[model samples]
Target chain A: MKPIELTEAQVKSRRSRNIAIALICVGLVVMFYLITIVKLGPSILNRAL
Target chain B: MSVINDHDPVTEIYISSAMPGDFFALLKPRVMSLVVFTALVGMMAAPGEIDPVLGVIAILCIAIGAGASGALNMWYDADIDAVMSRTKSRPIPSGAISKSEALGFGLILSAFSVAILGLAVNWFAAGLLAFTIFFYAVIYSMWLKRATPQNIVIGGAAGAFPPMIGWAVVTGGVSLESVILFAIIFIWTPPHFWALALFKSDDYKLAEIPMLPIVAGEASTKKQILAYSILLAPLGVAPWLLGFASIAYGVIATVFGAAFLWFAWRVYKMDEADRKMLPAKKMFGFSILYLFVLYAALLVESLLPKLLNLIGIA
Candidate 1:
């Protein structure tokens, strides 16, 4: 099989998309943490034996 | 992913590399946005509480499942999409993505979304998501799309499932409220699609897809559009009458529902001499607004008291 090369536009598009996905994932993590805190209140920090 | 047979020279030559953007495009983000919005409304309208984190997860699963359906649709419709001008630039037709790649992406996402929803949320919602993906990809895309003029009417069920799934995520089962939401979209779809078919008949003809306008005569299509619109107008206000929504929503639904009927009526009476089918175009555009505004009103009705209480105003 011959090796396939990505065009310049394809490379740029892929890079930008990866960046966007990364950003969205980070945002979701932070939002999840905050929502847990809001929902659980003081219990979030209360790790009992 | 089912690999396309590499017998065609064009496929071998043009499809050198696919970007992540192409895979994303296969997901049809615009359609996914609408699904997310409606599903979020469904969750809000449900009587029970969903933990915010779980709510987010449910929404994510629904969105991913919607994207899976879109990708699979693109995979299956690639041949017709290549011929239709409106779809000619889609990722698969444009050679930005391969059919096999899209099929794989859709399948993986479908499994992941369903599995995660089942594990993290309720299996009922997960089951609905799985069925929705299958219904759209297999039932709508593979079977109904080319088989009959009433394709949109049946295929519309796939689009109508998100809200029901959302409600199930909160309530752990389907309810009258969710079914009403489902009915609103299911009934609204025929007129919405037929209006577009009026103007895009040539595209359908070229693609050989038997859309209502292409299969039925234009006058017949127009009559059916008007009939569905009449049914839709009354159904739009069913929630308010059934006490699922407030009176304010009833008034808004009634006014917008009347406007929707007016547009459909104009389409019905439009002259063939009016080649642009402006009435049909107007009806199509307004139909989208009609669904969006009605759902937004319902969402506001559901969320307002909670929001006010959160802010100490209620």
Candidate 2:
């Protein structure tokens, strides 16, 4: 059987995609987290008194 | 500054290789946003008033501190990120930004954030922000990450400090309210991250990262997810019970907490072949909503009492 060798471009492309996804996940979590922070902080100010 | 700058060949090359996208990626804007928001909540929930200027300064310093951590994490994780399918295209890995540049960016920002927070806000707030940065970049990245699968479990606290620091920024000291906020995030971190791990186990395995799903089989990871969800319900309501919120908010918290546990239960009950793994996906989606709604409700509750007082009803 012949060995299936990957080109450098293929390997690099595959790796870059993973990073994009990771960055994306990080972004999603942060977006909600911030929305909560901004949304809640002022409300807390009014209610906690 | 010119829109036509892209017409120049030099500018074209720069844009392709070193875009603002690349630099913003280093800030880990996603991570920074969370730090900022939680800190904002802390500031609002704290018992005293903060000067608007000081509050803004504190948030900015924390943002920079978080960005600094992201840069440093990129510097260290560049190697692993280069290998994994989820992180390979990052600037360093993609040959866009050099490793030294990322490290220098991280270190400079770290010092800048800590110094600014100390000088502009209180030293205590600055000190806490500084530690949060160190915990994320040094403790979590340099040590716990590769050394243990429990990395996020312990390291998650680094991200949880923003509210505490924010509370300090307003009140000039740590309080129970901020600590409860921290606990909510800390508990949520495991299950939230574990959901990602459940779906992306192959990526972590490829990167040689010891995320729970990679080290333990799916069944064990699922069990742990249920366990965390079970603990998360009551913890979610801690802020309300401690006099940090009101009865209306308390009721909302209970409903939201129950819904989150239900989603976890669905995920737990799924058989391996359940409809292309919809259960995990549902759990993941609801998990995001669970945190957002939880915080949103807190914010709403915070304001409701004031609104009532203003209307001469409270």
Instruction: Give the number of the best model, judged by TM-score.
Output: 1
For model 2, how does the per-residue alpha-carbon lDDT over A7-48 read when each residue is reduced to its tens digit? 565466546656766886796467445544654666655765
Measured with C-alpha atoms, the lDDT of residue B5 in candidate 2 is 42
- Model 1: per-residue lDDT, tens digit, B80-185? 9999999999999998788888898899999988987887778999999999999999999999999999899999999999999999999999989899999999
Q: Reference contacts recovered by each candidate, as fractions?
A: 0.13, 0.00
- Which portions of model 1 show Cα errors greater than 4 Å? A1-49, B1-16
- lDDT at position B237, candidate 2: 82
Error (Å) of candidate 1 at residue B301 is 0.5
Stretch of 10 with least lDDT, candidate 2 chain B: B10-19
The collision pairs in model 1 are none
What Cα-based lDDT does every candidate model obtain?
Answer: 0.90, 0.79
Model 2, residue B1: C-alpha shift (Å): 21
Q: For model 1, what is the alpha-carbon lDDT of residue B177?
A: 85
